[model samples]
Target: MTTADDFRALHERPEPFLLPNPWDAGTARLLAHLGFPALATTSLGVANVVGRTRATRAEILANVREIAEATPLPVNADLENGFADDPAEAAQMIAEAADAGAVGASIEDHTGDRATPIYEFGLAVDRVRAAVETARQRSVVLTARCENLWLGVNDLSDTIKRLQAFEEAGADVLYAPGLRTLEEIRAVVSSVGKPVNVVMGFADPSITLEQLAEAGVRRISIGAALSRLALKSFVDGAREMLAGRFGFVGELPPITELQQAFD
Candidate 1:
């Protein structure tokens, strides 16, 4: 089966699957070796590594290409805002990402400006429609996202409204990244017929995989959570080194395991 077909089927399965986000080729391969069926690129994780608040389009696509090439697992590119305000420009990112070997992709309704965090309703829906057209041509599973909760707007009503519009616009999967509670997730899931994706980082840690699947979540992703945890470990170790302590080195395991994953 094609990668797109494989990825689309994962969302159709009875139980929810975890889609881990990797920032680079190495991490992508590592996650694949660890047995994930699919992988996603984390935009913020890339920004952190590149030393920018957000990496440029060229940088993001290069990273996508690298990760897609690194593993056999289906890859979902996080084409943030499609890197443009114009609908056509936004949709072009999907074509490039497909060319980069991504079987799936996401376009969020977030405007880069803090003052007006979301695109106006009409424009947002239009952009998603344009993207859906291109995604269909490319055979990519297009995920349309509502940024209200992700940006701290705390409006479930608006989130559901936008996702429904995107579902009507032909988005294969619907996502709202910052939902904090299962109640909100259930509300969104019940309002739409398409599969719903929830970011685990935004939800309560106590919530188990069974609970999410039972609540009608078909896909579960941890956006930048693992990458952030890796960074935390690095920072903590670096601090220990700065304090003239050599004890952290003693905690290291043999490099064989990581090397085996690379092999």
Candidate 2:
């Protein structure tokens, strides 16, 4: 089966599975070697590595290609806002992402304009529809994201409305990244008939995988959390060194283990 088919099958499993986002090829290979079923590319992670606030389609595709080449696991790309305000351009971006070896991709409703914050509801739905059509032609899994939660619009009712509309627009999976409570997550999953992908960072500590599965989540992704954690270690180690402490090196994985992981 193609990686796209394999990725689609992952959502059909009896329980939800974790899809960790890796920032680079090395991290992708290491995560695959550590036994993750699939991997995702974090746009935030990509932006950070490239020393920019945002990444262009060409940059994202390059990262996607590198990750796909580094591991056997299927790779999903975070195609933020589809890289365009026009539906046709958004659809074209999805096609390009598929060409870069992404088995799955996400298109968010955020417009990238701080003043406007998000696309109007009608336009957002159309954008997702266009992307979904393109993904269908390419056999790539399309994830439609509602950015209300992340865009400072913390309205659950509206978020549900957008997700439902996106589902009708033919999105294979629905996602809203900033949901904080199980009640909110379950409500989204129950309202959308399709598979729901939930972001799993800064979530309620009481919530567990079993709880999420029981609530009907089909996929869980840690977008940029792994990358942030890796950066946290580096920053902390550097700060300690500036304070005359070099103990952070002891926390590093053995050199032999690193070599073996890549081997």
Candidate 3:
């Protein structure tokens, strides 16, 4: 098995790669079969699958282990907020995630609020530093995410400042989820010397893989977009059937293919 050290070494390349996030073992294996170099666990997808409002500390670690065992490709855990209220507990959670065979993990600085929510810049940097220190014994890569985009803080300069601090704090990758502008993307890449991970979910994934590479992003992840697409298919199929319309059924993937894939 390739260790996390091996994965970390690959991130130094100038050209970036996409690290698509998958929800389950089957999805992970299929992506590996399709030639993706690595896969990340989607927190929203797993949390929805387990029927939990949000994935708990135990749930996230357990999911990482299960998915890691299912494939040989490197797995990066989307460990939401490190599953802790404080820096100490957050560090412990990062250690546990690394032990579960994760090559990398992401910690976001958002508090799930619409107004006045995110952690102060200093505190957020401390959390990333603590997480990196905890994973020092392991070879896990730590990504520090600033949710200023989602929080409606549209200033790219502020985002760059936060990412710069995270880089100084030992974060291997810096991510800003909702920044779709080329200017902002370029600014972030220039602000942090480490690799950058961008989420490609909006209608038009604004930046292409080539454009992102030129802008200096090292990784791209489609967070929950695939799962949502799958769910939309199910809902559309059901609605068609309820309306006595069988025409849309053929648009779905062949049942045999799904069955054989699982087999």
lDDT per residue as tens, model 2, 158-217: 999999999999999999989989999989988989999999874676789999999999
How far does residue 211 in candidate 3 sit from its true spot (Å)? 1.1
Model 2, residue 189: distance off in Å is 0.7
Estimated TM-score per prediction?
Answer: 0.98, 0.97, 0.92
Candidate 1 lDDT over 34-90, as tens digits, reads: 899999998888988977768888888988899999999999999999989999999
Residue 112, candidate 2: how far off, in angstroms? 0.2
Residue pair clashes in candidate 1? none
> lDDT per prediction?
0.93, 0.90, 0.82
Worst 10 residues of 2 by lDDT: 198-207
lDDT of 3 by residue, 177-253 (tens): 88877777888888778888878874146568888888888888898889888778878888988998988756767
Give Cα distance to truth, residue 187, candidate 3, Å.
1.2
lDDT of 2: 0.90
**True-structure RMSD for candidate 3:** 2.0
